[model samples]
Target: AEEARQTTQFEPLPKSLFQPLPPFEDLPRPLSPSGASALIDEAKQAVIDTGSPVLDTEAEPGFAVMRGLALHKLLQMLPGIAEAERRDAAARYLKRAGAQWPETERDKALASVATILADSHFDQLFASNSRAEVAVMGRLEVKGKLRSISGKIDRLAVTSGKVSIVDYKTNRPAPATLADVPPAYVLQLALYRALLQPLYPEHEVSAALLFTEAPRLIELPPAVMDNALARLTGA
Candidate 1:
């Protein structure tokens, strides 16, 4: 007769090095003085060297979000899967799933940030926010370039003869004075304005920030916008 069937059930494995870290870092160091653009350029070079496709248009946000979430998931289970496999599965699994992942923390953070938009509510709000409201959530595209760099515009409104360029801030609002606001925020909008300048030759390129987070308007004048463009172009 067949031996009595033996029964076994899976149990949680003993704790190992497979745990995850806190989602967000607690006040980690800031980006270097040179800023992120230099690092971006370096990455672009590496991609070119590896024959990666140049970004001609923005991909669907979901594609980005899923890729991000998968990475986070992989990081957590990598050790366990890795120990049973290569013992260095983080690098290999990342490659097998998708090669050429970004090495910098900023790019990873950006990927994670895209996850926020994956929320259907946020997506709906974003879509509704873009509708005729014209306060940002629109005007993001290659903006008429062969190989386009992505840009998130602040806002678009028809004011008399002018079409306003606007940006929103979830952080502390910048001061009305150019000197008072953070240089990066000013530059951020300035870059968008510059890229958009050729398209809107008629309207003056203006940059303003809505301090939704600060619950105030820290408006930067058009002159400040000009200064920002000047600095960007090294003019």
Candidate 2:
């Protein structure tokens, strides 16, 4: 019995069989517009990590964050309401949603919403043909990797001549020039343009950032969008 046992040669299992499986790259990567923006520009993530004042300077960020969200909600719902009723409706909505907020903050948000609704520059955006909270989904090639991105456009306007994508911003002092705009914002708008162009091939697709704080609309130029796309795809 001892000789039989000694003669039995036992081979070890292959290490490859025990190795961890490679990352699953085939699955679609779910990324929001903001997330894709940050992924494309590492600096954006760095700025977030550092809490750059350009983003926020709140002693208590929770209030600021919630305030922004409340404003966004108002913007989303305001377009559906009659323009004449928007001001009173906005006041009521904010009063309910912002009961815990300081009176000043609530009033400020109400004023901002009123200003955005009344801005003649954004008249086309709130037109009958426009849609708010538009869901967009598409696959984009990012530096040799394919990724799926999905996000909701704050507002999308479809006209006979053009398809407009508008993203609202609440920055206290919005970017004054194209050069001053954040890289992430540019990337976000550019990606939206790419995703929506195929849907409206006959019409020109345009994107812009509407700063609600001061009610300014800054349209991104074709050259700027093209450059951002080139950088994102590593072309």
Q: Which candidate is the best by TM-score?
A: 2
> How does each model score on TM-score?
0.37, 0.81
Please give, for residues 87-135, the per-residue lDDT of candidate 1 as tens digits.
3444455555544445552344333324433335333223322322222
Candidate 1: TM-score?
A: 0.37
Best by lDDT: 2
The Cα error of candidate 2 at residue 157, in Å, is: 0.2
Worst 10 residues of 2 by lDDT: 46-55
Model 2, 1-235: lDDT tens digits are 8867766765667899999999976786576666554455454443222222124354366666677778778888888888788888988888888899889878888987888788787789988899888999998888798878788898999999799999987766666887777777877888899899888889899999987767678999978998888877777
Pairs that collide in candidate 1 are 136-155, 154-166, 154-167, 155-166
Root-mean-square deviation (CA) per prediction: 24.4, 8.4
